[model samples]
Target: MWFTAGLLMAGAVVGNAVLIGQMSGREPVLVLARDVAWGQPVSGDDVKTVDLPVEVGAFAVREVAQAGIVGQVAGRNLHAGDLLAPDDLAAQAVPGPGQWVLGLRLEPGRYPARGLAPNDPIAVHPAPDEGVSSGSGTQQSGQEFPARVVHVSPPDADGAITADVLIPESTAPAAVEAAVGGAQVSLLGPPQK
Candidate 1:
């Protein structure tokens, strides 16, 4: 009984020492202090730093990079407590020159059930009810224009989602015409390389 007790004590001490050694090499990284909407600027108060094991720290936004990240637009919907990653920010404003931002008020079933986030690739189709006629005098419902989502809001009391999309200059006129009646947005797969 005495030998068995000594063996258990030694094992506990060795296990604790190993755990402490693994946790000792930590570095500070940025984590969100609050929820940040897509396209919204990141402020100093929006993030806080915490020490994490070096392995995870290697891929996280370093505490030193906070200055550069501040005032930058969020590339996605960053939830509170989310670890800041380099890809989580956009370096420039959305809808660069020659692009127009269009607001799409979509009802449930009109958009993907899974929901949308910033920078999501999408294709906008003319609402069939809108009866937009093409140059050939045919309805434009079958045509889709490529667009990128700038921001998407949660469903409101009426279950309507408001998505702001970046439309190319050439397609902005047609998109606006379609949006005046309503539009159906389809989430596309990840952009190809």
Candidate 2:
């Protein structure tokens, strides 16, 4: 009877060990507490730590690395509850050297009704000014250039949207010219997969 009791006790100890092992397998990793827009700096309040399985710790940013992540620019738009990965961060802010951020005022027909989001790839097309004769060779039409959406505001009372985009310095002049004459914006897709 003593031998049987010892065996039962040993079994209980082993079972408890297994349970502890499973619990310890999880490690702490940082996740976004709120949505972070691309090119925006991540503040301390934007992140929180959660315990996840060890397998996820391989690619997810560990909680201890939070110091390095804060103040860094986001490489892509990140949603709340997302596991923060290293690739989701950028080395510098938006409009990094040689880039310019421009705000384009778009009407209902000028932009997609589906709406635009940060980090979306877009093309700015120059629209001919009203009363400008299309027959005149001096007018340039159908000139579209690529730009990245930095921020988008809700439609105003007049159904106009304000979109701030990051464009290369070389294209700033053309983009400004287009904005002055009313440009058309087309959403290509998300900037990254």
Candidate 3:
């Protein structure tokens, strides 16, 4: 009887251990850029999941495949390895009333004579028509104003590229006119401190 009782107790202990191990859930890990897709499942294998030191509350994680690591999000810099929660990705640029977002499509090795990148300050100079500025001592006949590059499309052999430009509501008309007339767009670097 003693032997049977001991055997039964050992069996119960082993069973309980196995049951507890199975009940524990896997901890959440940080998703990596390569493993993340718009609707793909996030798992340890898909991203460089790390154990965060602090709790993230009830915020849910999302995989934004189209969003890149740049600019400020809630005044925070986004990096490649950082985890993106729902709230972190909620903020977006809201164009004010009468403001416009313009997209310029350029071919490979063309457009923005001085190379363009996101967040670049630029000036638009329209090429003067023949005989328009022959004696004016000005080769180009258009105004130069400040603008910023919001996005840059990837390069392709087909010369298909796109750039997003942000312009004030008041400047839209003149900018559009200049762009249509083969304006020479020059990207200017940020002012030195």
Candidate 4:
């Protein structure tokens, strides 16, 4: 009986040690806050946790120096240990080759669509030039196209904010030339497919 009890105690000790080791080996996931900066400590319940591969351990959030958390969105601050959603990490994915990227300059100094966020579907509307007025003296029918807002830029002198528009490769060339060559290109949200 004494020998059996000793063996059981030893097994328990080994089991507890293994459990502790496994727990210690587990790495904490980095969570990013929408407005927190890289390397900043996360406060309250702002972080989400997820398992990551050992190869990506360097990107893991460590207890010390918690600012390793990075925001998935550009132009926004990210905090450490904040659980990142798909959108948070979407920026890391590279666009497909052959995809057309067009820059739409927003009107100067106006935030008419400040609420526009990246990945938002938008429609492109090209205001007909005044010189293209119809016989009735009104501008020609405005050209409208569909696009996705891949990015938004700060305001610039042209009184327009530049948006990086992604469109099909086949239509990119004409769309870009028309927009950049002073033809109005209004961007609309993605059309319901």
Best model number under TM-score: 2
**In model 4, which regions exceed 4 Å deviation?**
1-27, 33-81, 85-94, 108-111, 157-159, 181-193
Per-candidate TM-score against the hidden true structure: 0.72, 0.86, 0.51, 0.49
lDDT of 1 by residue, 1-193 (tens): 9999999999999999998897788889999999987778899999999999999988889999999999898888898998999999997766668988889899888888888787788888877754467777766564579988887878999999998988889997768866777778888987579
lDDT of 2 by residue, 56-140 (tens): 8888999999999999989999999999999999878888999999998998899887888998889999887656655655665
**Per-model lDDT:** 0.85, 0.89, 0.55, 0.53
Evaluated with lDDT, which candidate comes out highest?
Answer: 2
* Global Cα lDDT for candidate 4: 0.53
Against the correct fold, how does model 1 do in TM-score?
0.72
Q: What is the lDDT, from 0 to 100, of the residue 127 in candidate 1?
A: 79
Clashing pairs in 2: none
User: What's the TM for model 3?
Assistant: 0.51
| Worst 10 contiguous positions by lDDT, candidate 1 | 126-135
Rank ordering of all candidates by lDDT, starting from the highest = 2, 1, 3, 4
TM-score of 2: 0.86
lDDT of 1 at 171: 93
